[model samples]
Target: MSYLLRCITCGEEYEPTETRYTCDKCGDLYGTLEVIYDYENIKIEKEFEPKGSIFQFKDLIPATSHTPIDQSIGGTPLYKFKGLLGFDELMIKFDGISFSSSYKDRASIIAVNKAIECGADTIYCASTGNAASSLALTAAGTALRTVIFVPSTIPKGKLTQLLVAGAEVIPINSTYDEVFSLSLRVGRKKGWYCRNSAINPYLLEGKKTGAYEILIQNDYKVPDYCFVGVGDGTVISGICKGFKEFYDLGLVDSVPIVIGVQSEKAATIKHVFDKGKPYTPIIEPANSVADSISVGNPRDVIKACKYVESTGGHFISVRDDEIIDSIKEMSRSTGIFSEPAGAAPYAGVKKMIRSGELKRTDSVCIVVTGNGLKDTDAVRSGVEVKTYDIDEAEALFL
Candidate 1:
């Protein structure tokens, strides 16, 4: 089976060897390329029990390399999260276990693998934190060099991971959007491979593997709804794409409604969704404790909005305080430590409950996207520190 790169807008097909991210005619950055698979030739005996890792579904993936830098990219556990806000059937897709402790590893692994296959030596991307760390780590495992451009205010925990991975980290005194734009320019100028989400269509192919894993792990049980915290809208888009592919392939009965959760400060996609039709993103200063999802201008807005609306889903935003509260509450209740963005879906769920949007009987799955330790500052701020002396051990115990 083989795959080709096709422009989602102009519908122009290109050989897999073509190295552009968008349609050559349209040149609309948001109108990015897509991975088109030749499904008829590929036959899957059983998607449930993959022979290896995500590569078991290699027929669907668009990469030429069967060998991955890390084989443990997929197969994350989907645990039953019982009795959350009186919902009987609630599950959490814990993707924090990805090699780099973030869901972005799904994309990084594929992007880096494709770069190596294409004979590129250096891979570049711009991220708030998780994407850069994942890309850096994956690139380090291979002979590829990694250059990450990040905002100066990136979390300390993620910054440490980038340095430890030996990637050339450039901290720019600017916002995420600025850093991302600069990365594109520099990558093009230096003839380096760009691993940025929404820019590289193969990244979505990798991320969509998580959705394939989720559906397979559930025994092909399609949930009524799927919730994800949206930053650049890549994750939700990938999940939507995966579900659609499975549904089309007759692997699943139906596709779940994908709900995109975003922070109030970073509600660019949400605002566009609410307006309907003329989907133009409005940029603003995105200030949120969930740094990972704090993007003023989502790169994959067009596809993300289309998928959510087509599936009868919604786009909702919660305040920074709400995100922090959800992080604390979810960590205590489920014993799953999640970063603010990872737990933002729960905040959206809370809003749904209050507004009567989500019912008590709806079977839903919330994607826990990243490890809480990635943003220790957010965790520390949520927890209260009490000073106790060894002499007053009784008080401490009490």
Candidate 2:
């Protein structure tokens, strides 16, 4: 790995051998370590092959070893919206096609590999659903063990996937933030490698591969705007980091305006951005249909806020009904079934257009982060079902 872990707060740099996830001097509860690449001396091939999804761009990632998995983690399709929802210059990155049916698969791939590289026997993390399922499946594929703590209120479908993947699932009767705090302490005490979002800098490296894939897939053209659903905000931060790297390497001339989507029920980070206030944890009862992107206190809010502001992006919050409607609209228009959180980006697009934040001529990309199958309850709520006999069905069709 041609990278070093740098503290985002203190600017202290450490060798890749250091396993610590936080700055020694920074007292913030959500400190993030960033990966600084040796871009000048790094090697890039004239013709790159994406044989192992993100690993195909192995030289860009921070892992020292390359272990291929059975399932691919990146290279999801970039499809045009085809004038869907009255937007012409819009595209969607279907990250839901991942093995775990979520964008977290990309990060899990790198986190599991980093675990194996560091010789860690067990890894632990706090997730609501997608992240846990992704980590569990990736660990299982790589012959690694994982302990995942999630809120008991997580969707039944995602919970089942975690258990079936053979992860030590501990569902706490509390909010995601509570589970996250407890998991961090327990992971440190048990000597298990913590793969928590924001804290694990390598995970960001993994998520950033999607940005690389988007640029490459679009023939190296940067979109005018990119919308992503934010929970703990690590995914968007990683994407911004990826685009920044490409810009520094002179691959792309400019970074896109990376907008963040949040459910109004749990839009703490969005509120902060909207008001232009100092960082403060907003703890409340967050009950949103888009459960995947519902977090009261995002762990990587600092990086997320900084990225969006610096890149000319804005944070938008949508109502639960808007999210549900977006799910059906996107599925109907694009034939891609997306979970509430995945559909959140579409809702953001609609809001941007209505509020004049996004223009009709501006190119856009909505990062559909997960599949609708992960949250069938939300999908079912938006769909209608009926059964009829053959004769009745034929008569209705006729």
Each prediction's total of clashing residue pairs, residues at least 3 apart in sequence or on different chains, is 0, 0
User: How close to the true structure is residue 333 of candidate 2, measured as C-alpha lDDT?
Assistant: 81
Per-residue CA lDDT of model 1 for 142-163, tens digit only, reads 8888999999999998999999
| lDDT of residue 350 for candidate 2 | 92
**Model 1 stretches astray by more than 4 angstroms:** 50-52, 64-68, 395-398
Tell me the lDDT of model 1 at 29.
Answer: 55
RMSD per prediction, one decimal? 1.7, 1.9
Q: Give the TM-score comparing model 2 with the true structure, all chains together.
A: 0.94
Per-model TM-score versus the true fold: 0.96, 0.94
Q: Please report the candidate that would top TM-score against the real structure.
A: 1
lDDT of each: 0.86, 0.83
- Looking at candidate 2, what is the lDDT of residue 379? 65
